[model samples]
Target: MTIKLMQGNEAIGMGAIAAGCRFYAGYPITPSTEVAEILSRELPKLGGKFIQMEDEIASMAAIIGARVGGLKSMTATSGPGFSLMQENLGYAAMAEIPCVIVNVQRLGPSTGQPTAASQGDVMQARWGTHGDHPMIALTPVTVRQSFDLTVKAFNLSEKFRTPVILLTDEIIGHMREPVKLPAFETIHPYEQVVADTPESYKAFRNEPGDVPPMAPFGRGYRYHITGLFHDEVGFPTQRLDEIDPWLERVNHKFDRHLDEIIMVESDFQEGAKTAIVTYGATARSARHALKIARQRGLKVSMLTLLTIWPFPETQVESLGDQVDRIIVPEMNLGQLALEVERMVGRRKVKRVNRANGEMVTPQMILDAIEG
Candidate 1:
């Protein structure tokens, strides 16, 4: 292991390489451009490929195609760029292509602030892509966790045969801190193994396990790939029998194994009546408030969400039972608070939100806790 001062965006680039990503294709966007910059310089050193696509749409398409051709692939973009990739992002989900997308979020309705930080993309990461599909999104509070979760994002994407989003904000994306990264060779990424012969391989087989092994396009296993609802053999099918099974498998795959997908950090005080629940960069502020609250004899706990999508409903629900009140701090105007409110209740959930490209500070949360 090597200890080094690393920025969060830099950590993501290093993590992608460590995760066995051999292909990166993206157009530059603020707070996220560093990921592409680092990868462009590093990928070629390891015999990997990096391409500067004309736009985010092509960038998303390129990575999917690279992954289809047997290389682990990824792309990075901000909000507007992320918007452009949504259609293709949906395609990757529908086609069951495993790829990682890094969205280093900026304040945005449409390029609202290029260099400003915001967690406004929380909902977009889950529902940005159209149609019903399983999505995995991981957020990190520290530089080290940024690297760690980027690797986790790739692993989950490959393991579940779905697109995984590394949802970050300008704060974590640009912030620098000391991180200890393991040797590249020591970091083992999950590889999808194809056990069946080409003739026996069914790309979208709805079998006992929801996740079927994927065979790359150029491999002897030449199977169809499309965005349409398809049969086990990957052919576009209109039959309810075929479509229903695919939908059931794809949608419920994450649900069936949610124990493995959902990750959270719980710092609980035995008699705590109030809890601070947050994710991404806001988690840093939440943690600080938690520390100060505890020091001042305010019995408060904190739940930091790492996996944002799939919501971690079970954990939040249980937290609701234990705590009298839940304070949710976010850079957005209470985006994630809605889910927390759903699990807990609006009455029990206190929201501290800011969407002006400014972070919800620890004092804001401390005030909420005291109030």
Candidate 2:
């Protein structure tokens, strides 16, 4: 393992290259621009390709096209750029294309703050893309986890045949820390195999609760790709028979593989009455609060979410059952708290929110707990 001090954005780039991501297409946006800048310089040296597209929408489209052309592909953007990419993001979901998207979030409604850290995009990452599509979004609390989760995002995207989002904020994006990474060549990416011949091909195979193998565009396999509901051969279809099974299979795969897609780190204490749940950089503050609370003779636990969507319902539900109350501190205005309330009920959830381009402080979270 080679150890180096690296920023979160740089680690994401290095992680992508290690995961066999050979093609990258993205527009430059603050906080996330470093990810693209690093790939531009590093990818060409590895015989991979990198191009700055016209804009976020084009960048999103280009990565999908590149992925269809048989390369592991990805893109990175900030809040505004991520919003622009939503249409294509939805397309990736409906078409079942495999690609990774990194959103280094900043304060936002529309370009609120370019350099400030905020996890306001948490809800957006899950539901920004239109329609009821399955999503896998992972949040990393440290620069090292940023590197680790970036690779995991690619692996999940390929395994599930969907777009996976590496959702980090500007704080984690710009923060630097020592990261020891495996040799890039030594990291084996997940691989998929297609049908033996064109004669035996079906673009969307009816695999029960599994993703169908995707054949490269020029690999002697020919099929249509569309956002519209499609059959096994990929032809546009409005037929209930074709649409229903695809819907069931795509949505249920994550539930079946929850252990793989959902990752969380928790510090639970027996007889604790409260649990502080957090993700992204706010988890740092939540930890501090936990320490103070413990020293002050309060029994408290903490749950740091590394995977946000699919929302870790089962675990949160368990926390709700075991604890007296759940406190959620987010850089957003309680976006994740809304989901927690749904799972655990509003009565069991308390929200500590900050969206003013500032990190939630330990005092703020501690106050919520003390109350």
Candidate 3:
């Protein structure tokens, strides 16, 4: 491995290539445009394809089509663009098409800020897609993790036959740092093709397992692809017998494979009275505050989330039970804090929030810990 100074967005773009992503389709949007820009320049050099779609909606649609064509596919967008892609994002989930969506979040209700940093999209990444579906959302704290997790996003998407969201923000996307990336040939992305003959293969079969391998569209593995609830053969179905089985399998798949889906890092004192729980860019400040609290002889711990969706509920609950108070720092008006409160009860949680275009400094978190 070689070390190089690279921006996080660039690292994500490079990581996708290393992860065997052969197709990228995106429309430029602030804070995240760099990912698309880098991939546009790099994909062609590596015998891959990159397309600039007319809009974010088309970009999302194109990647799914590309993935169905047997090429690992991805797209990158920010705030408004992400909103435009939601319908298609949900379609990818319903159709069980494995693709990666890199969302470099900016502050937004509706195009609120273009270059600003925010973690406001936390709920949107999980519930924005309109249906009851299991989603995997990974957030990276640094440039290196950005690269590492982008590859992980692709792997998880392929492994579970679902769309995976790489939830990032302006801070991590634009931050510059040195990272050691693995060789492309040495990296592995979960393959999603069936070995059996087409006649015997059922595209959406749930008989033997929750996930059935996806056969590439052009490899004589022709099957219907739609957002509607479908039968094992890929035809839209209304029968409760067919629908219930698909629902059970898709929803329980993540639960059965929690070991691989939930990822977190803990830095806790043996007997800490306070804890900082955070993810995405806010973890940077949380880490600094954790160090300061320890230096001041205060017992403290921190839980940094790498996977944001599927919520790591048990871990957070256990952490809440161990500490007298749980501090959550975010760049929004307490979006994730609402989830934490539900898990641990309102009495044990403290929130530090920032809605303006600025990073939450360590002092803000330190103050919360002391309070």
lDDT score, residue 158, model 1?
Answer: 94
Compare candidates 1 and 2 on TM-score and give the better one.
1
Give the alpha carbon lDDT tens digit for every residue of 40-68 in model 1. 99999999999999999999999999999
- For model 3, the local distance difference test gives 0.90
Selected candidate, larger lDDT, 1 vs 2? 1
**Candidate with best TM-score:** 1
Work out how many backbone clashes candidate 1 has. Answer: 0
Which has the better lDDT: candidate 1, or candidate 3? 1
For model 2, name the residue pairs that clash. none
How do the predictions measure up, each by TM-score? 0.98, 0.98, 0.98
Residue 213, model 1: lDDT of 86
Better of 2 and 3 by lDDT: 2
Q: Model 2 TM-score? A: 0.98
- lDDT leaderboard ranking: 1, 2, 3
What lDDT tens digits, residue by residue, belong to model 2 across residues 1-371?
A: 77788999999998998898999999999989999999999999989999989999999999999999999999999999999999999999989899999999999889898988899988888899888899999999999899889999999999889999999999999999888987777777888877458988887876779788888899789999998889998999899988899888877878778999899998999999999989999999999999999999999989899999889998888988889899999988889999999989999999998989999999999998899
What CA RMSD would candidate 2 show?
Answer: 1.1
